[model samples]
Target: MANSNDSWFQTTAAREIHLEQLKQAERFNGRAAMLGIVIGIITEGLTGAGIAHQIGLGPLVDGYAACRTQFLPFCF
Candidate 1:
């Protein structure tokens, strides 16, 4: 009985720590979402692919297209 109760008490501390960490994660996730919203507004409704292209991923996208067209023609 004593050992069983001891295990339960120990778990509360671990559970509290996990809850604290989850709270911190939620905070950062909200901030990131807000930042994305601001970026979307600034870009005037540019979607993810458009934003990637604007930020210099255009060539990477083009390269992927070239690869698909050449080797894996049925890829994407």
Candidate 2:
């Protein structure tokens, strides 16, 4: 009976530890995703490639049009 109880306790402890590690990993991944979004916004702002420019195809539209038939959407 004592041996059985000891084995059960050990299994429970290991399970708890594994659960805690998984929670910590989830938090870290959430933070990393947020950090990536912030960095992406910063990059777009600095590079002047905001939503408007991207949707309008700004300076690259001409290139695309020039080879639209050749590349299906991209020139060269």
Candidate 3:
């Protein structure tokens, strides 16, 4: 009898099941990426801010610059 703990790739049926799961995961990942792109574009069009600014990195960068120049306590 085969060991219950044997790797799935050792059998044809297990390999097919694994491949099908991979395909489903790939499809879901692709859809999620497309949705993110669409949302970013729409948000940019509505708010005039790029994705980075929309996600709030803009202010953080500005603060870093300010701290470098003025030695602000918040920089710590």
Candidate 4:
């Protein structure tokens, strides 16, 4: 605990770093969310590709068809 006369600067550097990291965390939450969404899209797209392959739609169309879930982002 700190006295009234003491500034937070009086705390250990590790404690200060922890508080800084918390502040940084607030900024990173949105970035993390976006990253998760991107990962989800990629996984879903790969899944679609596997389905296309299983259906034997031919390599070209099937390859594209499989990943169309990902392409939806651009086609929109």
Cα-based lDDT for every prediction:
0.76, 0.76, 0.80, 0.64
Ranking, TM-score, top scorer first: 2, 3, 1, 4
Per-residue C-alpha lDDT of model 3 across residues 1-76, encoded as one tens digit per residue: 3575454436867788899999999999999999998999999999898887888766556687557766466773
* Candidate closest to the true structure, highest lDDT: 3
Cα lDDT of model 4 by residue, 1-76, tens digit: 5574375555666698899999899779978988877776776587754433444654545356446656333332
Question: In model 4, what is the error at residue 43, expressed in angstroms?
Answer: 0.8
TM-score of each: 0.51, 0.62, 0.62, 0.33
Model 3 residue 66 lDDT score: 53
Candidate 2: tens digits of C-alpha lDDT, residues 4-62: 99999999999999999999999999999999778768868888776445567654545
Candidate 4 displacement at residue 47 in angstroms? 0.4
Q: For candidate 4, give the lDDT of residue 67.
A: 62
- TM-score-wise, the better of 1 and 4 is 1
Tell me model 1's lDDT, rounded to 2 decimals: 0.76
For candidate 1, report its TM-score: 0.51
